[model samples]
Target: MTAVTKIFHDRLQVILDNHVAEVRLDHAERHNCMDVAMIDALLEAQVWLAERVGVRAVVLLGEGESFCSGLDVAAVVSTPERIAWLLQPDATGMTPAQRLALGWRDVGGPVVAALHGHVFGAGLQMALAADIRIVHPEASLALPEIEWGLVADMGVSVSGAALRQDVIHDMMLTGRHLSGEEAVILGLASRLDEDPREGGRELAQSLALRSPRAVAAARRLRREAPAMSERECLERESGLQRNLIGGPEQREATRARLEGRRPRLA
Candidate 1:
């Protein structure tokens, strides 16, 4: 029996297809903005994915024209206590905002984000947490927190996007937006495609076919090594390589390469 439950809440959808799970932000009328309810749905989804041992890849995409448009200011401000609640950590020891932004990453599998339209603030943070990002040309991303006299807090500091200090400062100070093409050029996006959703699925499928162990290890190294010193990073890399070089997954990968065919390893 499948261990994962099919959840279709008001603001989110969790659907598993084969080994690739798709988590969709579905509140399109509000540009799929992150509110308290959606955040809770995402938290539940993180646990769902974490418990599903058969899932090899995760694809996060929005339901409408936009992937996400950051927080719902009107909704958030309407509730006085909600703002304070966003800062409270759940059972996962992660704040609500952090859990929503980084939940997909917590799953021990590759996460691919397909972005289009407005990818702002928390949306961009989610993309940053993704191991691979595929964005459409028309997508526009921004950190508009400064305009609202707020910081783009949502645990965005650990984002793996290769943005320079100057670029980060400029965007944060001005709340400026970046196009999808520019995002790719600036290393915020892995690649640009006409149909980002399809592209994300293709990338996730490719990852799902690979050895999950190797994929997870590489993702961890890429996602976390930036915070380490050069020497520490190098040592970690070598240690991971040594641990993987002769492992079952590596051996299967090698055999598949030698046979000139797709690997059939589990």
Candidate 2:
């Protein structure tokens, strides 16, 4: 495990279990606000997890009181120097912030976001990328980018397309916050729970019990389900299967099943 640095200490944390990875946004002092460092940390965390060979699922959560309160206002408002710094790109080939919000969609395994408290602006955009969003009753979600004098560049257009047009328009234009219940009713959150963390943990555990290859294939299928044609879907399925068959992980899975033992996957 890498040690959290002061620059990104409040931004993110990663814990890799046997086959499940948990990533927590930890900037409680500022409601887990998104900042340059925080964004970099998030990108790094995802990149790290994607390269790992054993993870079958990922659970994203927030530490302390909230998931995220959106961009760090202080970082933007404090001074011209700070603003410039925040706008600079990272050196690790991290995708742009907008694309970074879509990273969860590209991960091979399922991603479940456990949201609670304030989830606004960029925060909400990040959560929207997850395959499943489980929100606590007290969670509040919104898109305040328009009010902040900016167009939402953080993949909102793509992710929000999953929701009803009117719902997306309402959040973007009005900056209206939605409680967890409201989000569920509006088809934003997948489920509601009293404690998002426990709910997320249970869900991840259940998912981990499944075959890793099956979960990955299901994720790929779900991502293309909304807009892809049957022909395109079949082509994608073929490509993914070609990459998985005889691969180290796939071979281990097959061998384990035949031997009736837990697979020791790479």
Q: What TM-score does candidate 2 get on C-alpha atoms? A: 0.80
The digit string of per-residue lDDT tens for model 2 on 38-154 reads 877887777777787767778888898998889886665766775554455667443367655888765557889999999998889999988899999789999988887876667
Q: Which pairs in model 1 have colliding backbones?
A: none
Q: Looking at model 2, which ten-residue stretch has the lowest summed lDDT?
A: 1-10
Against the reference, the lDDT scores of all candidates come to 0.83, 0.79
Clash count of each predicted structure: 0, 0
- Candidate RMSDs in Å, in order, are 2.1, 4.2
Which residue runs of candidate 2 sit more than 4 Å off their true CA positions? 1-10, 77-95, 230-266
Best by lDDT: 1
Clashes of 2: 0
- For model 1, what is the alpha-carbon lDDT of residue 42? 78
